[model samples]
Target: MLTTRIRNVDTDAQADAGMQSLNEPDFKALVDSHPKAIMLTAQDGSIAYVNDQFERVTGYRQEEIVGHNPSILSSGMHSREFYIDMWQSLERDKRWEGLIWNRRKNGETYPQWLNIYPVEHEGGAFYTGVFMDVGELTANDERLAALAYYDPLTELPNRTLFQEFLKARACQREPADRCFAVLFIDLDFFKSVNDLHGHDYGDRVLKQAAVCIQGVLRKGDLVARLSGDEFAAIVELQEPSEINAVCERMASAFRKPVSVDFREYFLSASVGAALYPRHAESASDLLLKADRAMYAAKTAGRACYRVYSAEESEQGQHQQMLSEALVASLKVAPEEFSVMYQPQYDLRSGAMVGMEALMRWRHPELGAVSPGEFVPLAEQRGLIHELTEQLVRCITRDLTRHDFGTHGNMRLAINISARQIADDRLEVLLEPFFTRLQLAGWCPELEITETHLMNLSPRCLDKLRDFGKRGVMVAIDDFGTGYSSLAYLHALPVHVLKIDRQFVQRLGPDSRDSRIVSAILGIADALELEVVAEGIETEAQKAKLQELNCHRGQGFLMARPTPLESLVRQATSG
Candidate 1:
């Protein structure tokens, strides 16, 4: 009845008179003054009544719009299927709410947040639509999108957006016609810039570097900041030579000194290029090839570019094969992996004070795979966590079966990878072993590389400290090989420092390494921490370490890494 009355009052004068009659006067006033625009349509889909806000928002007077279909405001931006879905929802649920684009009387398109509800009356069913222009909200959404898809410091597309664009661009063309190159660019000696000048100056250099890189790329190309001191570009090319030309231009761009605070600093870039469809079929594979090529360039010495070559491709293929084989071995043949323990000795007393657990893999086809070779590979393939868990299980089982704690106050040290230390699951996995060792009066030690220790977050350091409180010792393995900062040496919750083999093997009278080792021992003594010299191969090296008061050492001279069963057998024989 209300719809019929409103529809009949089409003239402006009649509409004004009929508005109060169509509904309560207070209700009509409230609807008219409401902030949101409102429209009422008859069951036949013709506009019946519109509130004052609706006329102002749509730029159409009530009399002019009455009796017209709501489609008169359509922006034609939505497909037919979109409208079909909207109507289907309205019919099924009696209400619909969504964002829509509509045109005003002046032909200006604007986005609106709209809500529609069905009303039943004596005359027929009416539909009421309430909406508001959301142009400002849309602008805010765009700002949020930019934040998500860009690196704030350099204002370049981040890794997420770069990968998205790479995938999208690949999809837009046929596989055979996917002619492009991905260039992985790493700034050489950029860490020294941050180390020498602080992060503020480093940030300014990165921003300038971004501008310089973009200057070398074509208008249609995309360059993104992949991470700190690293950038990647998607380059369109007509031929393979064009990729080389682009890389040379990028290298040349960095030859110019970066200026900060009237000071000049020279920085060069190592660029690696891999072509699409030629190097790899997928974007991820292409990016990996580019990264590998970039590392090769860095190895060749900085400030140069290297195209992905057949040699690199062959190496990549070998790595791929190894990765696949490793995955299969992990899933189907975990028994191929076992734990070996090497005794750590007290050089002064000639007593075995500790044993370090080492991981050994014997593949059926590959024979003995060196931990040096496969361990880093496992880390890169994200299989390190799984491997570490398996090793933990094997070590715990061996310790329990052999009753290793019965061998006097022997401490057990397990090498923990950075990945494992950062993984929360690792704490859960090692908790039971910690409890067992605590009950047995044996101090269990976790050996983290000095490099990883320095890079660890405060949270990870806190975790190590918590372990210390629980009587678990934290030892820094391969000390002096990484940052070796005295700052962390004082700050980290460490119990022992294992001198790296590199420094230990060169120990001699008046040699630089011997002095370095002496300095390390002095620092450890001043800090009241224990020291273990690694890789002692000869009587002279062991004697030199003892002369330096290193006290504890582990090497082939004392004992090589052997399976727990073999070590137990040797003890039984003795």
Candidate 2:
């Protein structure tokens, strides 16, 4: 029996009245009859009665729980404001349906969905709370192989999952409701955690991060892990001001350091957010814009957030389409992808020396894409080798029409990369060009950049050596970019050091530039390799090369890079 007090709720009554039931209806028994925990509390929040379900959930007997303040069940999960607000609602009208968490007698805690209502009589008012175990909700959530589309650690949706979620969510929105927002969260420098402590530890850091994030969430908000080091959330708001409040709270919650493995670690996230219906009508549009906004946050430096704008997203989509088109262009007929030869000339004699076969693509949609643009893109997309193969075939074909054979025998140089040097089948790939064009001694020079030389493996070095033995001339395209590259000149199978344009730009009055150019020439002279001063646009820069005994150069001073046919005409005319 619960002690009953009909009078206004008092401190002494609140403290002791729970010991004796005032013949109050056996509501606790009703709760026990059903299978979930139930409790009856007086107007002041002291437990007056508890059902057997409550005892089982909290590991306390009815007696142990009775007469105690309901605070015994508090697991420090809810804020002081949470309890204050719940009671305030009871004092006013009463009836709150939501979830709360509490600790068991043994100290383990779990969540419960609660329905609290005011029990009023002619005598006084009381609160009755009925709670069901939500353990199963999360249980089934975890056991179900959680759609492969989600990032498991954060329970955040992956990109594929996000796209599907966005699509479904977008269709649900009405034209009038344009208030929902999508946020993309990226863990800044998260790779360093994996590199320094191993991925296992990195996974823990990420999971811990998720728990901290959950602390800031309001009801009806959905947060999903987008991918490794990236998280996404959908904030459903009825008003625009709510967006700022939600984002600010979420960003600030990351202020305290994360505790992992008995150590404190600091981590920050960059958040890119976009409003639904406002920024995009389609799923891909929403995601693409959010991604750009995230990149903006990252670019601005970490621990920041940016909202997506329509214009930014459109520009990003345009770039994606362009990049996609550039990739598709490469698969067309070989004739669509052509080479433009830039003629290198002998400075003293003013006669054309050799030609550098530069790549050009007359893409169907995007016409006349340059090598500088597509080459970097291809390298990233790992299409450089295929592009190079196409180049070899083109150069081999163009050699037949070259009138440069009249000017003391000139060769065409084609650029290659570290990727080409590592391939054992590279020589095999070149055999077609060599055999088809009858690769005579030094018929084509293979050009490589400073980066290619620095990254070369021993197998790659051996491959370059093999090319040298096969009468393939190798030239280091840019000389002074990487450290000790000049030192590696002889060890490399290179026959030419194309002085990077940096030295030539300063040649007019700077003796420092002149000396640097002179030093490079002396090194090349000692190594018995040729030196070509690149980007010699001024006649003064060109005549200075003659003074330094540098024999060859290429730049606008000779002529802007011309097509192979024009290159043949110019070299032959000279």
Candidate 3:
């Protein structure tokens, strides 16, 4: 509403009187005293009168604006069709309410919620427009849209946005012109980064990785973070070679170091690609093929890319089914899973000093499934945390039920997943296990791979150090197979090293494995760490390991991985 002098006319009261009841003088006063921004435009769209509020909102004097067309305040933000539609609504309904961006006399553009209503007078017909500022509302709408479609950490388009983009592009073209590529990328060893450095550093690495990915793509291509550590891209393909070049550039971009917290961390990513028309017809299928190809790249030893193939797609589908089944099974019937203990013998004493608990799965319909098959799948699906918890609970219950720990004082060796160690609540989870073991007079050792140790973040290192202080023996399993620096190995809070089977399998006089074994034993001796030789299948291997003073050994020759009942009988009988 406007507030300005209107000669002797009561324009404010006249407007409230619907203009018909008021004389010209009363109409003038009525329009002048109104509080809203009210502008009266003649039938031809020329400005008839503007109230004080109109001049205040537009920063124009009434005399300067009154003689001009309402177009003088146009922000140039709307198209001709917009005005055509607005007039259509005004004519049909007598009033139209909408938002418009208009420029002020100071050249600043702002949004306003405007209403246009027809006004009839004895002389002629006119329209009165009432408007108020709504710039903040416009900004809030944009902010809500961004929060819905973007990843907060990376600020890249998220899965919901990516799907919308794919849908829009698919509908924008004919089938023949629908040629594009979808590349699914998974960061390698990213979990280790989270485990070692902390999630904040991991998030920084992901943000940098997103930027690197965007830098490599063509101008029209779309890159998005599908989820944590997984990114997807939509690329326009010209020649088939373009996909290869783009993938190479993507991998190269990720190969660089990401500096976080004053430390530089190197990372690698595996890419899987699916080409439109060639790989599949739909965006969902294309994404699926690309995901399968990505898993194939992981299977081929990582740091590479693979194009979709029928074989890889089949295998990927099977793996996905298994992953889903694992998630469902964990929720519905985890007790359907079981643990078996493999005896670990002391070569010098010829006695069972410990047993390593191994997970075994037997589905009601799928029959027996190897831990090798399902464990990694669970890790991929983020079910490993639950699986590990179930495993500890089962093993602890078995130990308590059989009284095996008291029977032979046999130590229980449990393999720990990186996810378990990274969990903030790991101390609480392990409290029961430690309490039960202490009551049984048996100490439990946690086995971790040498590779898992190599990437220990400072946080992971500190957590393991704390666990070690609590008297849980930390042993490195599959030692020789992983590349770990002596500096890192010496600094680790480890009490034992289990020589990998590949190294122990070749144990003989003057062999390379023998020399490596001797060196490992010497390092262990200097560090006051115990050494265990794994996969010793013969008396000859055992004798050779004993000659090198290896403290312990385990393999099929001692006993196969048996059920808890069998392990209990053996321990109690001994």
Candidate 4:
């Protein structure tokens, strides 16, 4: 008594016109011959039809299941929340597919791969479910467990499995015998690899890095990919000296370049370690301390390792207090923040051609907070956008009040962070500031760090190109300090390169720094980019730069950073 509701079509007229269409009986025959079990139900969940395969698979005849709901086959193995989630997906996405356990007519439960989708007919809406028995597919539990607990890209243990291992190892053993260390590994400049090359290339790099790291560890050690470009390892050591030896091996692993499709990438890691029963007692605390130490390694130049220390914990707490204070100050007393200008000079002409805008904050209780300390905190707290907006407002107001006189058309440079560049609203935020600069006949320049410039997203690069089209100049600050590839420099819309103070201060004829500066100037000349020598404190350094044909310079020797009022008065008097 199996039946299907079919739409009324003109078979007689179609035959006269020599057209072919399947009648209801033919459609039913096709369904009966399908290899997989198929069931049709009404919108109200009452079973309407079952194919031959469905009868064979479930051991149920059509007559007995016609009026019953599919819930009759539910094996009670899944929770209510599981069914809720499945239905939510069906309602929102209009289809669902997963594995489920169902009871057969013989009262035996088995796993089945099920797919449910909605169908519309002339009669009404209907639900069709197609399923297959998957008990044999999951018979190999180790393979199934691998899918559940391992990262597919690197074929390493995932964070969930790593945590389970850590907890069992630390808690199951006696406190005295818990003598293992946790190392947090973060790949340095991995984002640049992903940004410069496509994600496929980056994936290969990650796979190779995983192999390199795992090859160095002992058989009992465990390595897991915590997240993107971040990994963790569990190493057992007999003495503290063993920790250094293991970390050095891990650092050496990345020294060799990773080659992917004929392109070579130099990769490195920042490692931080924390020992059990020493730095921390619990697994979670050990992991956290290790992560903090890893960040310290990054701060102290990457490709290195640091063990957890009490002083680092104190610094972390102090940073947290500063972060909270910054949030409060931004909301209540924003006036404590201001902008100062440090003039840049023409080395040959000895005239002020431009000035860099520096952000300053004076906390009433803390006296003066360094930009290095709070700027990063603001970025971490997601308050950098607000800080940048405030900076622009202050610059606009101050410029409006003080006239530059003879230095009217000078270039005004402002520092831009990577987060600000990635923000979609950066254009709108700077539109008014751009207009103000245009009205004053002053040129606006954006100064970005060399490291950030190499890691900019494609969309951010497009935004920078658009800014260039709008007449905003782009300069790479602290040149030669970061791992910038020549290809990126050539591809970027760069107008100037500012030599870092580290190299400029050591500018002697026979010194390596002098040779580096010379090489930088040569590259700039070949690229048609201007060069600015920073930290020109001594006359000898200035003369050396001038002899090398470097034109622009900025340092304490030329002029110190001054308030807007003082800067205007000094320029007018000079």
Candidate 3 lands at a TM-score of 0.68
- Please give the RMSD to the true structure for each candidate, in Å: 12.9, 12.0, 10.1, 15.3
What clash pairs does model 4 have?
A: none
Q: Model 2, residue 335: displacement in angstroms?
A: 3.9
Q: Residue-wise lDDT of candidate 3 within 1-574, one digit each (tens)?
A: 2111122333544444443432377777888787668888654446777788788788988889875788888776565656776777876998887656788999987656677887777544567888765433222345535335567677766786677556434433434544788999999978878887899888888888888888889887878899999999999987556788888887777777876667888888899998877887666888888999998887766788888899887887777777777887888987788898888888999987888899988888778888988987777666777888888878877865775545345677888776567677677778778767767777778898888778777888889888888878999999988997788788998999999999888878889999999999999998899999989898889899999999999999989999888877776777
lDDT of 4 by residue, 209-312 (tens): 88888988997788899999999999988766688888888888887787777878999888999988788877799999999888777666679988888787
TM-score of each: 0.57, 0.57, 0.68, 0.57
Show model 1 residue runs off by greater than 4 Å.
Answer: 1-216, 222-272, 275-306
Tens digits of lDDT, candidate 1, 99-166: 67788999987656678887654334567899876543322345535335567787777787677567
Steric clash count of candidate 2 = 9
lDDT of 4 at 96: 82
Name the weakest run of 10 consecutive residues (lDDT summed) in model 2: 1-10
Checking candidate 2 for backbone clashes, the offending pairs are: 1-21, 2-20, 2-21, 2-22, 3-20, 3-21, 156-224, 156-225, 157-225
